[model samples]
Target chain A: MSRVVVDVVLKPEISDPQGQAVLGALGRLGHDSVRSVRQGKHFVLEVEGTPDEAELKQIAETLLANPVIEDVELHLPKD
Target chain B: MRIGVITFPGSLDDVDAARAVRLAGGEPVALWHADHDLKDVDAVVLPGGFSYGDYLRAGAIAARSPLMADVVAAAGDGMPVLGICNGFQVLCEAGLLPGALTRNSHLHFRNRDQVLVVERADTAWTQDYRPGQRIVIPVKNGEGRYVAADADLDRLEGEGRVVFRYAGGNPNGSSRDIAGVTSENGRVVGLMPHPEHAIEDLTGPSTDGLGFFTSVLKAVVAA
Candidate 1:
């Protein structure tokens, strides 16, 4: 069995309002050292058999992320 | 003219959209998300709502529904399609339109009457209005901020594809105050306002939105 992890985040050019809100709260709570906070989605997938990078990339690009506003990164489990 | 109002599982404004069509003298055909049929409608309206509970993303899942396949094709063949609010997000996700609707910069679910200036009246959906007409419509959504690459925005502005712009003030911080835009051929339009809810004087901010429904009939006749 293999587990694939995907992280999806908004593009840098796109405004992250939620992240900004969190940053505001962090400052109020006295976490001044923290510079920024960008929110994103993380998904872990379990497959019966090991999947190739291309297949997982297609899944990440197609369903897990929107190319227009979001970027995606994949993390495959080590053997 | 027959106008199709699609109802995804979580759609909340299908009935209102259909009523707008009926009030505008067009037959409102109910279309389902899972069904592949378009019911031979002359035009289509993707109404406002939190389809799929906005799970993965607003309108993302619904954009990939079986019926959307047909919508993409018909829209390509010059069938007029209007996407409102969440519907606009779906159109962007489905690649029928450019850009994406993200959470409002204020991170609030904004609901209010908004004044918009009609920039283009020659499209399949805006023919009933004169250019630069100011109309009042209800704008409501959490994810209504429109974001696009700088180059795309410039091109759209150059081509006059921007159909509507906020007049008084920007509600959701959309790029250049753009409330709505059109496809290259001017057939498909997507906007982050509730035109369907603004069709009746008693129930809406104004009857200004009736033009969108009425315009499609003329568009069909002209076709």
Candidate 2:
């Protein structure tokens, strides 16, 4: 079995309203050092065999993330 | 021909959607999320609510539910499907519709009677009204903002796929003032308003929402 870690995040062009709200809350809480905050989803997957990088990318593109507004990153399991 | 309404665990409007179907002179069939069987229904309605408690994303969890596979296939065969509110979220997450519903721009759950202009009367759901007809219906949601890529938005607008546009004022800051949209083939539609809630004047602000139900009947007969 192989393990795969995928992270889906909104594209730079799309507005991150939730992250902006959190940034505002941080300033209100007196944490002024924080410059920016971008939020995204992290998912872990276990597959029976060692899937190729192309397969992983296809899965992430087709199902894990919406390419129109989001980008995806795949972390393959170490040997 | 019967309209099937699938009830997810946390669905809040399945009953009302079925009632609206009955009122529109169509038999209503109750379906379940876990069940893959579609029960030979002629059409399907994914009613609104916080399905799967809106975990992962508003409709992300429910979009992958067992029944949705069947729903997607049936929709591919030209079966009409309408999604309202959270149901609209599910359709987007499932890739049956474009765009995503994000948190309201003003950061509050809005609930009120909203006016919408029908942009296209060609969809199976909006054929009862003429193009540019105005109607009032209730829209309630916090994550109802619709967003898409600039190119996709241009395509949607250019191809006349937009079904409804918010009128008077943009309530939730949806891009291009889009309140609803139809699929490429016009067999599927998703909207952020509660048409079923506005079908009866005794309980709702207006009966303008009945056009959606009646429009489907007309389409079904014409088909």
Candidate 3:
């Protein structure tokens, strides 16, 4: 079985309070090396066969991510 | 007047929505997420709760549910529809409304009494209140911050479609302090606050929320 993964994150223009809170917590924990953090969602889909990039994009855009406030990226093996 | 209250799995406020409809002298019809039948109701209410267990994102799954297809079509026909809290998210995700509700800008779930100014009273849900009227209702939510493209927001503002604006401190950092909005035709209304929960003074911070239900009933009577 092949797995296709999609990562959804708030667009740069959108404010991410959850991510900002994590950054604050990291600072409190003294993780000075980390400059910033942006929170996002990750979805791993196990399909019967490796789907082409076009089909994957449709899935991510239609169901996995909201285009209004989020950006989506697909992780797939190069053909 | 019959108002259909859709109960998606994990919905916490459908009962309250029904109660509000009944209190407003309208029949409350129960609608299920999986059912295509709208039960011939004159209006529809997408009540609040973590539909689909809020999987993936709040209201995302429920927006794509089977019954939403019917709701969308009916809404297009100018049937009055109201969405509360998670219901608001569902309406946005379903393309029935513009903008999205994200995590509260403060990164916390806030629940409290909130004051709102009725900016537009022409909508199917707000006809009972006068413009600039101030009302108190209970607001409870986590991802209630509203965000939209600048141009879309400007249009919503320029057209005077904003139904409710925060009068007190902005509770969830919603852009432009918007607490609720109405469709271009004013047939659909969506808001982050729980009007259904504030119908009775005995249980809620105030009975101001009852105006929304009463307004819809009035709309039906006039129609």
Q: Which candidate is the best by DockQ?
A: 3
lDDT of 2 by residue, B1-223 (tens): 6889999989999999999998888899999999999998888899999998887678888888999999999999899999999999999998899998887888889999999999999889998889989999999999898999888999999988899999988888899999999999998999999999988879999988888888887777777
Off by over 4 Å in 3: none
Model 2 Cα lDDT, one tens digit per residue, A1-79: 8889999998887778888899999999999999888889999998888868898899898778877678899999888
* Local error of candidate 3 at residue B206 (angstroms): 1.9
| Candidate 3 lDDT score at position A67 | 95
Per-residue lDDT of model 1, residues A1-79, tens digit only:
7889999999999989999999999999999999999999999999778778898999899888998889999999888
Pairs of residues at least 3 apart in sequence or in different chains that clash in candidate 3: none
lDDT tens string, model 3, B1-223?
A: 9999999998999999999999988999999999999999999999998898888889999999999999999999899999999999999999998899988998789999999999998899998899999999989998999999888899999998789998879999999999999888999999999888788878998889999999999887777
Models ranked on lDDT? 1, 3, 2
| Interface RMSD for candidates 1 onward, in order | 0.7, 1.8, 0.7
Instruction: Please report how far candidate 1 places residue B198 from its true position, in Å.
Output: 1.4
The regions of model 2 sitting more than 4 angstroms off are A1-3, A30-33, A44-59
The CAPRI class of candidate 1 is high
Query: Model 3, residue B64: displacement in angstroms?
Result: 0.7
Of 2 and 3, the candidate ahead on DockQ is 3
Indicate which candidate wins on lDDT. 1
Ranking by TM-score: 1, 3, 2
For each candidate, the DockQ is 0.85, 0.45, 0.89
Query: Cα deviation in Å at residue B125, candidate 2?
Result: 0.8
